[model samples]
Target: MNNRFKAVLFGVLLVYGLMLSASFILALFVRFDWISTQSLDWLPFLISLTIMLLGGGLSGFRSSEKGWLSGVLVGVIYTVMIMLYQFLAHDVWLHDGQWLHFITFLLASISGGIIGVQLNQRND
Candidate 1:
């Protein structure tokens, strides 16, 4: 595979790993009563932002052109992967308001890609 593809894959994996780690830590905290679910309701959004930003940035860094497009592709891939997993594992379907979150993820990713491309240009 090309370097850009490899970078996007790496970014996705990195995001997934970080998310898994975060989930484990959150579970531990909840089990120990160190945190409550109600208070941490925003965690998912935060995690999603991080995932898109990191993934998009990596993609943009490696992409030869159209960094925003690359970022959008990465975001879409990640969203589809997560949705598919949820469907397969829990039979869950997309509910109301979820689309907004998805849009936010896409926008965040695009912004990250822009920044990454600019940074790469600067470095060169």
Candidate 2:
């Protein structure tokens, strides 16, 4: 397999893994009344930003060049996966504010990818 492809694959997987773990933990917290659901309204946004950034960073680190491209690929793939999931599971074709979220997430990932490249360069 190509190194770049491996990088993107791992990045996506890492994001999904983190999301699963986070969901489980949050579910536990909610189930046990450790946190109020009302107060966790920002949870999705936070998680999306954080996970995408991490994934983009990983992709950039592994690719070792063209960080922005890596970030864009990761963001697009992630968004497509999400759309597929919603369509298959919930029978939903579209959602409000999708573009806003996509743009924000993409920018966050791009920023992270650039940072990751800088870090890699510094280490080299």
Candidate 3:
């Protein structure tokens, strides 16, 4: 409801839109034989990391303090949303193998938040 939370949500939505666009493009490429599907096996993980990083950065920029905490919260929320969607759509659940992806996302988001806070401070 607050400005910071709103910014985080906006960032998440923005990333999701970008991901959807990318997926569509990839699908087209695959359909046309321009790229092999096997090459895109890592796309989902990369997209997830990117989304969390951008979302956390936005949150940190808008928040008054506790940038790391804000980043962590954003990362967790994003992951949960993604997992829930996957579960509902594909009946998939998290497995032990996915822990690395989650950790990577969290770390990337925290790093982004730190950068955002630093940038905001510099601009002030």
Candidate 4:
């Protein structure tokens, strides 16, 4: 497969993997009452932002070109995957202000891609 495609796929997978890991940890914490249930409110957005950046960085480093585009692809694919899963599994539509998530995630990934490219260049 092409490096760009591979990068994008890997990036999406990485995001999902990290998300699952985060969810599992959160569940454990909640089960133990170590963190209040209210903590679930804004934690997901923060987790997504950081995880997307890491995923985008991996894609940018692997693709080594058009890092912004790779990041965008990663963000889009990841979002679509979630949407599809929710639609198919839960039969749920998006609630209000969900578009903001897409925009925020895309921007985070883009920034990460740019940083990753610079880092890759420095390592070369």
Provide backbone clash counts, one per model.
Answer: 0, 0, 0, 0
Question: lDDT tens string, model 3, 38-107?
Answer: 8988876787677677777777777746678777877777678879988999898887877778788888
Over 1-124, each residue of candidate 4 has an lDDT whose tens digit, in order, gives 9989998888888888999999999899999999999878989889989999998998888888888988999888888888888889999877688889978998888877777777888899
lDDT against the true structure, each candidate? 0.80, 0.86, 0.76, 0.87
Instruction: List the candidate numbers ranked by lDDT, top first.
Output: 4, 2, 1, 3
Give the TM-score comparing model 4 with the true structure, all chains together: 0.95
Of 3 and 4, which scores higher on TM-score?
Answer: 4
Q: Residue pairs in steric clash, candidate 1? A: none
| Model 4, global lDDT | 0.87
* Weakest 10 consecutive residues of candidate 4 by summed lDDT: 110-119
Model 2 misplaced regions, further than 4 Å? none
Ranking by TM-score: 4, 2, 1, 3
Candidate 1 — which residues are off by over 4 angstroms?
A: none
Per lDDT, the best of the predicted structures is: 4
Identify the runs in model 3 with alpha carbons over 4 angstroms from their true place. Answer: none
TM-score for candidate 1? 0.88
Model 2: worst 10 consecutive residues (lDDT sum): 108-117
Candidate 2 structure quality by residue, lDDT tens digits, 3-66: 7788788888888898889899999999999998998988878998999999999988888888
